[model samples]
Target chain A: MTALLKIDGLRKRFGGNEAVKNVSFEVNPGECVVLAGDNGAGKSTVIKMISGVYQPTDGKVYMNGALLTGKTPEAVRTAGIETIYQDLALADNLDPGLNLYLGREAVKHVLRFPYLDRKKMREDAAKVMLSLGIVVPDPAAPVREMSGGQRQAIAIARAIHWQAGIVIMDEPTAALGVPEQREVMALIERLKKQGVGIILISHNLPDIFAAADRIIVLARGVVAGERRPAETNDEEIVRMMMGATL
Target chain B: MTDNTVNGSNTNTKPGGTSFVRSLLNAWSWLFLILILGFFEIYAQTQTGSTLLFRIYNLQAISIAASQILLLGLGLTLVIVAGHIDLSIAFSTGFAAVVMALIIRTAGADAGWVTVILAMLAGLGAAALVGAVNGWLVAILNVPSFIGTLGTYGIARGAALIVAGGATVSIRNDHTRAFGNGDILGLPVPLVVAAVLTLICHYLLKHTRFGAHTYALGANRASVERAGVNVKKHLILLFILSAFTAGIGGLIYTSRFSAGAANAGEPILLYAVAAVFIGGASLTGGQGTITGTVIGAFIIAVIQFGLVFCGLPPYWQFVAVGLVIIVAVLVDQSKDRLMGGKS
Candidate 1:
């Protein structure tokens, strides 16, 4: 089958330095692909271009053989590409339901006026959490009241419910405790089984090995190498990321 | 589950009365309570009427004042929530009203409703245009909203003065005057308009994509932009909302006075700002609701009416209002600190 999502010859520049230089990759459906790189690597820049946060200086993005480059963020979302940022992009003051349904609120007719379907939205939010095996006291609870793991889970649920074909998460397990990390790992596995393609940006070798079906390593805005997790060990992967011969 | 540090307090509290209290504190409910108590005491002593009934009786009066403030506050709330302030709403309202009067005279009596509608539209259009300029200056040119709106404050006030010719334009038409004096279901027409506007605004702010986008833009523009939202577009729309609401307020003012004056809305600004701030809206933006603003508007109105009913000097009303505003804000902050920012 054709790649579900493909990036070809992506290059980005800021002032004098090249942030992402002619990187290309493909992710098949239901594949959990990890983009592994160090602090100065161009992983984020590439992801940004793919998610329509920033247009590439030069590149073509294809979603199931359809060109998707240069589209607006809302358009990208409609095309089934969802991105979960490092901060999770949640409204702390709003309840879980409102946050989950943010910008995509459901409307009901009330005497010829459009009123929000708050009850339906709240119910959907609960169902989303329940499907993720996450429990909360109430769907109406403010996100600020939730723990880090719960917040991450809620973000994942948000993307999942939106029916994203490709979900790109930036450090989903960062700052999370071991149990929380485990919870997220399980969620990732579940997404793969559900036929959702995932791009996980991470630095942890153990996590990449544990969760990623394939790994794409980036160095100085270039794809250093690619590997299948079953065939490669941690040392070789680290060497590939660091651009060193061992 | 292994990390107990996540639930160190183990406070799986089901949002008890304390949460309600917290909401009230954030909502500036104490100020309203004090105003009610003071009114009850003074109305009891001065009048031979039932104090309870009198308080209920004054709801119309309070509603009148609250509606005005609510109209202005709704506009300002959007600006504030987007991490900006619009101090020109008072002058904008005044100018809009003055323009309405001019339109009425030009359009003739036969075109009364047309004049009213056009005037309201013109006022809103003018204010929104000005607001768009304000956003452009702030978002594109990098000027602060305080300064931009303050500058527009003078400009709007001058336009009002010019339109009114430094005098109140009194309405002689009985039909037009009826709009101000008429009651609908025991409520003043202005109050009814205000109530409807508030409900619509409450829904818009709580349930629309625009509302969510505004909150996102206010809290963190960079993150919101990264998430693919057009930050500048939302900012412009928010400012437009603020100015348009103020324009609506101008219509109400003209109807209430049966005249349009250049300086009519001068005192309304302080009260509107106070209401938004007192109702848990932060100057820092990303917080506040139309519901909170409605309550805040009524709280201010009740206090003002209470002082007058209590046989206090009119000037003392300002002092009492100022005190309540300061105290309510202090309590709001204290409550936030008490909640340890989890709120």
Candidate 2:
């Protein structure tokens, strides 16, 4: 099967310091590609470039063979690439339904003037959360009162609701509890089943192993090595993360 | 676990119970208004041997006073909720008033209703220009709203002064005077106008996608931008809406008083901003309602009118209104703490 997302020779430079250098990767449909690295590694830079948060010094990013380079983050999202930031990028004052629809809201026309269809949006939010095995008891409550796991779930639900072809998650489970982390891993499995391509940036070894179909270790601004989980172990991946030669 | 169940039980209880309390807390401004009215009514009965709340004349007087501030606050409420301020609205009101009166005076006292309508439009147009300038400064130029609007505040003040020749411009027209003071359906014209505008604003803020984005924009601007919204355009539109409402206040000022001064909206600015805050909006944005702002305006109006009715000095009205504003903000802050800290 053809790859859903392709990053070719991505490089980023901040004045004299090169943040990301010659990183190349591809994610096929229904696959999870984890970018594993130590602190100061180029994982974030690479993802930022792909997500259009940063314009690469030199590189190309393609989704479904369409050039996505240099587009705004909003444009990239419109092209079906959703990035769930580490902060979740949620408006704390808004309820899940509003959060789910955010920039794109459902409206019903009255005398040809459109008003928010809040009831339908709320019902749909509940249905989507329920399908993901998460229950938001009060759909009307603003997301600020929600647990970290619930908030994370809401972010994922937003991506899924939009039918994103590719999802880039940056440390989605970092602030979550053990069970919540497991829930996120399960959600990843569900996304894979839905044939969504995922590029996950994670530091947790166990989580990396559990969720990734292939692991790409980055060190000193370049991919040190790439290996399938079945063909590699934790020590090898860690060594690769620490700049060990393949 | 077969399913990763979220223990929403604990979360559910907080909103279900505290929301009741939170809503009650939100209604503190209304409660304060009622409390003050009661105090004034008792004072009127015991001292003057008459009624304060029961008298139609007294209620009309208070509502008319409130109607002015309400018009100004109606738009500023949206501005503040979007995490911005429009200090220029003060002089925007004055500028519109001056322009409208000038048009009427120039057209001659016996000019037809069409002239009056054209003058009103001209007044609104001038105010919208100020709004657009404020929008361009804040949105496109990346200036802080407070400073940008403050700059325009001075400019608008100067423009009003120049347009009115540094004084009030008086007008004489039966149609304009009737519009200003006439009654409709047993309600004073100004009050009726305010009521209709209030309903429209309430619907816009509560039910429209534009309103939703305003709330989101104030809450977290980055989120709205990332959500694919044209935040710059929205900000521009917001400032224009703010100026538009203040312009209406100016139009009413000219119509009701038969004259428009360069400083017509100067004194009303403080009351308008106070009404917004007392209505439960925060400096941090992302909170507040039009209903709350309406109550807030009435609270100020009652305090001002009640103090006068109680035979206090005019200066005492300032002190009383200031005290009420402080109390309203305190209540708002505490309500935030009670609702699980800042969002």
Highest TM-score: give the candidate number. 2
All candidates: interface RMSD: 5.2, 3.2
User: Cα lDDT of model 1 overall?
Assistant: 0.78
Docking category of candidate 1 = incorrect
Error of model 2, residue B271, in angstroms: 1.1
**C-alpha TM-scores of all predictions:** 0.85, 0.93
Each prediction's DockQ?
0.21, 0.53
User: Model 1 chain B, poorest ten-residue lDDT window?
Assistant: B1-10
Compared with the true structure, what per-residue lDDT tens digits does model 2 show for residues B167-281? 8999999999999999999999989989988988988898898899999988899888888889999999999999999999999999999998888899999999999999989
Per-residue lDDT for A1-246 in model 2, tens only? 889999999999999999898999999999999999998898899988988999999999999999999998878988999999988878888899999999889999989878899888888898788777787768998888777777888898998899899999999889877877877887788788889999999989999999999999999899999999999999988988986434
The TM-score of candidate 2's chain A against the true chain A comes to: 0.95
Best-performing candidate as measured by lDDT: 2
* Model 1 C-alpha lDDT per residue in residues B18-69, reported as the tens digit of each score: 7877776664564566657666666766684545324656777877888888
Q: Which stretches of candidate 2 lie over 4 Å from their true place?
A: A12-18, A54-59, A65-72, A175-183, A230-234, A244-246, B1-4, B7-20, B341-343
lDDT at position B245, candidate 2? 91
